[model samples]
Target: MKIAIVGTRGIPNHYGGFEQFADFLSQGLVQKGHDITVYSSKNHPYKESDYNGVKILHKYDPEDKIGTAGQFIYDLLCMADARKRGFDIIYLLGYTSSSVWQRILIKKSIVVTNMDGLEWMRSKYSKQVQRFLKYAEKLATKYSDHLVADSIGIQSYLKKTYNAESFYIPYGSHVFSEPNKEDLIAYGVTAYNYDILIARFEPENNIEMILEAFSKSSTSRKLLLIGNFKHTDFGIRMARLYGEDTRICFLGPIYNQVALNNLRYFSNLYYHGHSVGGTNPSLLEAMGSSSLICYHNNDFNRTIVGNDGFPFDNYNGLKEIIEGKRKEDFFHFLTENIEKIKNIYSWQRIVDRYEDYFLSIIPKS
Candidate 1:
C-alpha cells in the first residue's frame, strides 16, 4: 500500500506526540513492505530524503516566520502536494489547520483522520480560536472517509456529539529495559530519590498546580520539571513563583528519547497533569518506563492507566498523596503497567493494529 502521512512537523521527531507517532509508524509500516511517504516540515533538522527505509517529503513550513498562522499555509502546501501523489491512504494526523482545506484532499485516496484531543477545551486558546477549532473538528469529521480516536473517551464523544463512529487506537511506547544509574548523574539527581513531571508549560497541562502541590509537600525529594517553560508568559510566571524553592529543579525540554525514558525509569514518582489530551504519548511512555505514575484524574487518563495508577484531581489531592504513607513495595502497579505496555501499547502491537485496520478498509487490488 502507498500511504502518505500529513499533519505533523516531521519524522526525526524534533517535536512532540504526532511526530513521534509518524516516526515509529512509518518505519514500522516500511518494515512490513508497505510504501510509506511521510510529509515533513522544511525546517526539520533531518535534511535527508529517507529515514530508516521510509520516504520523507519535506514541504515548506513558514511557522517560524509567520507564527501559528503559518501552520495553515504549511498544511495547505502538504495537502496540495498530496493531491498529486497516487496514495492508497492519506492519513491526516490532526485537523487543527488542515481540515479547513479538506476539499482539496485527493478523492481517490481513502482519507483517515486521527481526531486529536478536544482542542476547544484547551485553556491556552482564546474563545475565538476555540470556536475555530470546533469548526475545524466538524470539517474534519464531515470530510474524512474514516476517523480515529486515540482514547475511548474521544471515541464516545465523537459518537455522542457528531453521531459519528471512530476507530479507537491509542498511542504506543516501548518498554525501557536499559536502566543506567549513571544517566542520573548528569542531571544532578540520584536513582528513585526525585519526583519528575514532563509536559509543555501550558495552563491546561496543570503545570503550576503540580508544582504547587510539590511545594506544599515537606519531603526533601527534588521535583524536577522537564519542559520549555521560559518562552510562554504563563511559564515565566510559574518560574518566578516557584523558582525560589530549593527542592524544585526546572530542567528544560529534553528531546532525547533514551534520556527521557531513563529519567522516568529512575524517578520516585512521575506526575502527568495533562487534563486535556486523549491517550497521551508521554503517559504511555511513563508506564513503559515502569514509573510509579500519578496522573491527572480524567476519563482520557483513566482509560489508559485503569486501576494501575494514582489519580489526583487537584493540588490538595496530589499533595496528600505525596505526603501519605509509603508502600512497602509498588511492584504490583509497576508490573501491571509494564505488562500492559508489552501486550497492548507496544510499538509492534500498535503497528499491527494500524496495518489490520488499513487493510480492512482498503480493498485488495
Candidate 2:
C-alpha cells in the first residue's frame, strides 16, 4: 500500500515525539514493502530526497522566520501536495495546524489522524487560543475517516467529549541495554549520582514545580534538565531562579539519542513532569532505559505506567519522595518498565499494529 505521512517537522526526529514516530514508523512500514512517503519541512537538516528506503518530500516551512503561524502555511502546503499523490493512506501524526485544511485532503485516501493531547488544556496558551484549539480539534474529528488515540486516557476523553470512537495505539520505544559510563564523564556525573528531567520548558510540564521540589530537598545528586530552556520567557525565568543552585544544571536540548539513553540509564531517578499529552514518548523512553521514574500523577501518565513507578502530584509530594525512604525494590520497577517496552511499546509491535490497521481500514476495491 502507498502511504503518505503528514503532520510533523520531518524524519530523523530533530524536533519532538511525532517526528520520532514518523521516523520509526515510516522506515518500519517501508521494510514491510509498503510504499511510504513522508512530508518534511524544507528546512529539515536532511537534504536528501530519500531516507533509509523511504521517500522524503520537503515542503515550504517558514516557522524559523515568521514564528508559529508559519506552521499553518506549511501544513497547507503539505495537504495540498498530498491531495495529488494518490496515496492509499494519509496518516497525520498530529491535528494541530492541518485540521483547518481537512476539506482539501484527498477524498480517495483513508485519512487517519493521531489526536494528540488535549491542546486546550495546555497552560501556555491564552483562553482565546485554547478556544481556537478546541475548535480545531472538533474539525479534525469531524473530517478524518479514522482517529488514533495514543493513550487509554485520550481514547476515553474522545468518547466522552465527542462521542467518537478511536483506535488506541500508544507511542513506541526501544529498550536500552547499553550503559556507557564514559558518556556520563562528559556531563560531569557518575552512575546513579544524578537525576534527570527531559522535556520542553513549558508551564504545563511542571518544570518549575519539580525544580522547587529539588531545591527544597537535601539530595546531593545533580539535577540535569535537558530541553531548550534558553529560548522562552518562562524558561529564562526558571533559569534565573534555579541557576544559582549548585546542584541544578540546565544542559539545554541534547538531540543525541545515544547520549540521552545513557544518561537516563545511569541516572538515579528520572523525573517526568509532563501534565498533558497522551503516552508521551519521553516517558516511554525513560521506562525503556531502565530508569526508576517519578511521574506527574494524572490519568494520562497513570494509564501508561500503572503501578510500575512513583507518582507525585505536587512539589511537596515530590520533595518527600526525593528525601524519603527506599522502601520499594529498585530493580522491580526497572524490569517491569523494560518488559512493557519489549511486549507492548516496542517499535516492531507498533509498526505491525499500524500496518494491520491501515490494511483493515482501506476500502475494498
Candidate 3:
C-alpha cells in the first residue's frame, strides 16, 4: 500500500519523540514492502534524495518559525502535495488546523493521526497557542478515520475529552551495547558513575525541580543532564545555573545514537521529570538500557514501569528517593519489568501493530 506520513519535522530523528516515532515507523513499514513517503521540512539539512527505502519530500516554507504556526504552514503545503500524489493513506503524527484543511481537500484519503500527548495542557505554550491547539485537536478527532494514542493514559484522555476510541501503540526501545573503555575515558567517566536525565529543558519537564532535589541529595553519583540548550528560555537559564556545578554536568544535546546509547547504558540511574507527555522516548530508552528509573509523575511513570521504579511529585519526594529515604524493591522489580518491556515495546512489534491497523482501514476492491 502507498502511504504518506505527515505532521513531523521530518526523519532521521534529531529532534523530539514524534519525529523519532515517524522515522522508525516509516522505515519499518518500508521494510515490510509498503510504499512510504515522509514529508520533511526543507530547512532541515539532512534531506537526502532517499532514506532507507522511503521517499523524502522536502516542503519549503521560509516564513515558517519553529512553533505550532510554522508547523501548520508546512503541513498545509505537504497536504496539498500529498493529495496530488494520490497516497492510499495519510498518517498524521499530530494535530493542527492544516489537518482540518487536509480533510476538506482530500475526501477519499484514509486519515490516521497519532494524537501524541496533550500539547495544549503543557505549560510551555502561550494561552493563545493553547486555545488554537484545543480547536485543532477537536477537528482532528472529528475528521480523522483512525486515531492512535501512544500510552494508555493518553488513550484515556482522548476517550474522556472527545469520547473518541483510539488504538494504543506504545513506543519501542533497544538495549545498548557497552561502550569501549577508551570511549568512556573521553567523556571522563567510568561506567555506571553517574545518573542521567535526557529531555528538552522545558518547565513541563520539571528540570529545575530535579536539579534542586539532586543537588541537595547525599548520593555520591554524579548527575548528567542532556538536552537542547536553545529549545526554550528555561533551557538557557537552567544551563547557566546548573552548568557551573561540579557534581552536575550539563552536556548539550548529544544526537549521535552510539554516544547517547552508551551514556544511557552506563548510567547508574535515569531521571525523568516530565510531568506531561505520554510514553516519553527517553524513559523507554533508559528502561531498554536496564537503567534504574526515578521519574516525576506517579501516574505517568507507573503506567510505564509499573512498581518497578520510583515516582515523585515534588522536589521533596525526589530528594527522599535520591537520599534513600524511600527504599522499596526497585532493583528486583526493574529486572522483572525489563522482560515485559522487551516483549511489548520492540520496534518490529510496534510497526506490525501499525500495519495491521492501517490494513483494517483500507476499503475492499
Candidate 4:
C-alpha cells in the first residue's frame, strides 16, 4: 500500500508527540512491506534520504511561525500535491489547516487522522485560535474516513462531543537501557537518587505546583525537571525560579536519547503534572522504564496506572508522596503492572495494531 503521512513539522522526532508517532509508524510500516512516504517540512534539517525504507518528501512552507496562517498555507500546498500524487491512504496527525485542506482536495483518499488531544481545551491558545480549532476539528472528523484516538480519554471525548467513532490506539514508549557511570557524570549527577518530570513547561502541565511541592518537601531525593525553556514565558519563569535551586534541577531540554533514557531509567520516581491531554509520551516512557508513577490528574492517570500509583491535584497531596507516605503503593503498582504495560504499549505491538487498521482500510482487488 502507498501511504502518505500529513501534518507534522517533519521527522527524526526532535519535536513533540505527532512527529515521534509519524517516525515510528512510517518506519515500522515500511519494514512490514508497505510503501510509506511522509510529508515533512522542507525546513527540517534532514537530507532527502530514505529513513529505513520509507521515503521522505519535504514540502516547503512560506510562513515561519507554525500558527494558524502558516499551517493553512502549508496544508494547501500539501493537499494540492497529494491530489496529484495519488496515494492509497493519507494519514493526518493533527487537525491543522493542512488536514482541513487535504480533506477538501483529496476526496478519494482514504483519510485517517489522529485527533491528538482536545486542543480547544489547552490553555495556550487564544479565544480566536480555540474557536478556529473547534471548527477545524469538526471538519476533520466529518470528512475523514477514520479517526485514531491516542487514548481512551480522547476516544471518549470524540464520541461524546462529536459523536464520532474512533479507533483507540495509544502511543508507544521508547524504552532505554540503564545509563553508564560516564553518562550520569556528564549530567553532573553524582547518583540517580532523584525523581524525574519531563514535559514542556506550560500552564496546563502544572510545573509551578510540582516545583513548589518538591521544594517544600524534606525528602533527600532531588527533582529533575527537563524541557525546552525557550519555548514560552512559562518555561522562562520556571527556569529562573527553579534553575538555581539545589533540590530542583532544571536540565533544560535533553534531545539525546541515551541521556534521556538514562535519566528516565535511573529515576526513583516519575512525576506527570499534565492535567489535560490524553496518554502522555513521558508517562508511557516512565512506565516502560519501570519507574514509579505519580501524576497530577486522577481521571487520566488512573486509567493508565490504576489505583496503585499516587494522583495529586494540589501541592499538599504531592508533598505527601514526597514525604514517603505513598511510596510503597506506587512501587507496588510499578512492580506488578510494569510487565503488562511493557507488553501493551511497546512500539512493535502498537505498530502491529496500526498495520491491521491500515490493511482494514484498503479496498479489495
Candidate 5:
C-alpha cells in the first residue's frame, strides 16, 4: 500500500507526541513492506529525501515566522501536494488545521484521522478559537473514513459528543532498565533524589498548578521540570514563579532520549499533569521506564494506569500524595505498567492495528 502521513511537523521528531508517533509508525509500516511517504516542513533540520525506508517530502512550513496560524498554510500545502499523488491512504495524525480543508483533501486516498484530544476544552485558547475547534473536530470527523482514539476515554467522548465511533489504539512505550546513577551527575542531580515532570508548558498541562504544589511540598526531593520553559506564557510565568525555589529546578527541554529515559528510570516519582490528551507519549514512556507515576485524576490517565499509580484531583491532592504514606508494593505496579507497554501499547501492535484498519477500509472497486 502507498500511504502518505500528514498533520505533523514530520519525522526524526524534533517536536512532540504526534511527530514521534509518525516517525515510529511510518518506519514500522515500512518494515512491513508498505510504501510510506511522510510530509515534512521545508525548514526541517533533516534534508534527507528518505529515512528508515520511508520517503520524505517537504512543503513550505513557515511555522516559526508566522506562529500558530502558519500551520494552516502548511497543512493546506501538504493536502494540495497530496492530491497529485496516488496514495492508497492518507493518515492524518491530528485535525487541528486540516479538518476545514476536507473539501480540498486528496481524492486518491482514504483519510484516517487520529482525533488526539478535546482541543476546545483547553483553557489556553480564547472562546472564539475554542468554538472553531469544536467545529473543526466535527468537520474532521465528517471527512474521515475512520477515526483512531488513543484511549478509551477519547473513544467514549467521540461517541457521546458527535456520535462518532473510533478504533481504540493507545500509544507505545520503550521500557528502560534500572538507570545509570552516573547519568544524573551531568544534569547536576542524583538518582532517586528528585521527582520529575516532563511536559510542554501549556495551560492544559497544569504546569503552574504543579509548580505551586511543589512550592509547598514538604518533601526534600527536588522537582525537576523538563519542558520548553520559554515557549509559552504559562511556562514563562511558571518559571518566574517557581525559579526561586531551591528545591525546584527547571532544566528546559531535554530531547536526548537516553538522558530522559535514565532520568525517569532513576526518579523517585513522575508527575503527569496533562489534562486534555489521550494516551500521552510521555506518560507511557514514564510508565515503561519504571517511574512511579503521580498522575492527574482523569478518565484518560486512569484508564491507562488503573490502580497501578497514585492519582491526584488537584494540586492539593497531589501535594497530599507527595507528603503522605508511600505505597508498599509500588515495584509490582511499575513492572505491570512496563508489561502493559510490551503487550498492549507496543509500536508493533499499533502498526498492526493501523494496517488492518487500512486494509479493511480500502475502496472496493
Candidate 6:
C-alpha cells in the first residue's frame, strides 16, 4: 500500500497530536512493507529528506510569515502535489485548511479524513471563523471517501449532524516505564513529587480555570506548567498572574519525548484541562505513563479515560479534588488506566487497525 499523509507539520512530531500520529502511523505502515510519504512544513527543525524509512516532502508553510492565511496556501500546495502523485490513499489529518479545495480532491485517490474534535464549537474562534470552520467540516465530509472519528463522542457528532458513518479509531500511547532520574533534576522536582499540567494556554483548553484552581489550593506539591508560555496573551497573563508564587513553576515547552515522558511518569498527579479535542494525545501519554489523570469532564475525555480517572468541570470542582482527600479507589483508577493503555490504546494496535482500514477501502483495481 502506498500512502501520502497531508495537512501536518510532519514526522518526528515537533508539533502536536496529528503530527505525532503521522510520525507513528507512517513509520508503522513502512515497517509493514508499505510505501509511505509524509508532507512536512519547510520550517520543521528536522531538515532531513527521510525519517525512519518513510519519505519526506517539504511544503512551504508561511505561518511564521503570513500567520493563519499561510495554512490555506500550504494545504493547497500539498493537495496539488498529492493529486499529481497518484498514491493509493491520501490521508488528511484535519479539515481547517484542506476543505477549501474539496472540488479538486474528488477522484484523486482514496481520500480519508480524521474528523478531529468540534473545531467550529470552540470558543476561541470568532463567530465568523467558526462559521467558516463549520463550512469546512461540511465540505470535508462531502469530499472524503471515508471518515475516522478519534473518539465515540466525535463519531456521534458526525452521525447526528451529517448522518455520516465514520470509523472509530482513537489515538494510542506507548507505556513508558524506565525513565532516567537525571531528567527531572534540572526541573528541581523529584519523581512523584510535583503535579503537572500541559496545554496551549488557550481559552477552550480552560488553562485559566486550571490555574485558578491550582492557585486557590494550598497544596504542598508544586505545579509545573509545560507549554510555550510567551506565545499568547492568555499565556503571558497566566504567567504574570502566578509569577509571584514560588510554588507555580512555569517550565517552558519541553518537546523532547524522553523528558516529557519522565515528567508524566513521575508526576504525582496530571491535569488535562482541554475542554475540546478527540482522544487527546497528551492524555494518552499520561495513561501510557500510568500517571493519574484529572481531566475536564466531557464526552470526549470521558470516553478515553473511562471511570478510571478523575473528572471536573470548574475550578471549585477541581480545587476540591486537588486539595481534598485522595480516594481509596484512586489506586484502582491507576491500575485500570494502565490496563486500558496496554490492551485498548497501544500504538501498535492502532497502527495495525489503520492499515486494515486503508486496505479494506482501497479501490479494487
Query: Against the true structure, what is each candidate's TM-score?
Result: 0.98, 0.98, 0.93, 0.93, 0.97, 0.97
Give lDDT tens digits, candidate 4, residues 238-350: 87887677878877898887777777666777888887777777788777676777788656667877775678889898888877743434566766556656688889899
Candidate 5 is scored at a TM of 0.97
Local distance difference test, each candidate: 0.91, 0.92, 0.80, 0.79, 0.88, 0.88
lDDT leaderboard ranking: 2, 1, 6, 5, 3, 4
State how far residue 135 of model 4 sits from its true place (Å).
1.5
Worst 10 residues of 3 by lDDT: 325-334
Candidate 3 has an lDDT of 0.80
Model 4 segments more than 4 A misplaced? 63-68, 325-331
Q: What is candidate 6's lDDT per residue for 161-236, written digit by digit as tens?
A: 9999999999988888787879999899987768899888788888888888888898888889999989988889
RMSD of 4: 2.1
Please report the TM-score between candidate 4 and the true structure. Answer: 0.93
- Model 3 agreement with the true structure over 140-223: per-residue lDDT tens digits: 888888888988998998999899999999888775556554555657777777788998878988889989988888887788
lDDT of 2 by residue, 247-352 (tens): 9999999988999999999888888999888999999999999988998999999988878888999888899887762423588888988999999999999999
Give the alpha carbon lDDT tens digit for every residue of 1-365 in model 1.
89999999998899899999999999999999999999999999999999999999999999999999999999999988898888999999999999998888747688999999998889888999999999999999999999999999999999999999999899999999999888888899988788899998899888888888889898888889999999788988998999999999888899788888999998888998888869999999999998988888999999989788899998889998777724336768999999999999999999999999999989777
* Best-fitting candidate, scored by lDDT: 2
TM-score of 3: 0.93
Candidate 6 error regions (>4 Å): 325-329
What CA root-mean-square deviation does each model show from the true structure?
1.1, 1.2, 2.3, 2.1, 1.5, 1.4
Q: What is the RMSD of candidate 1? A: 1.1
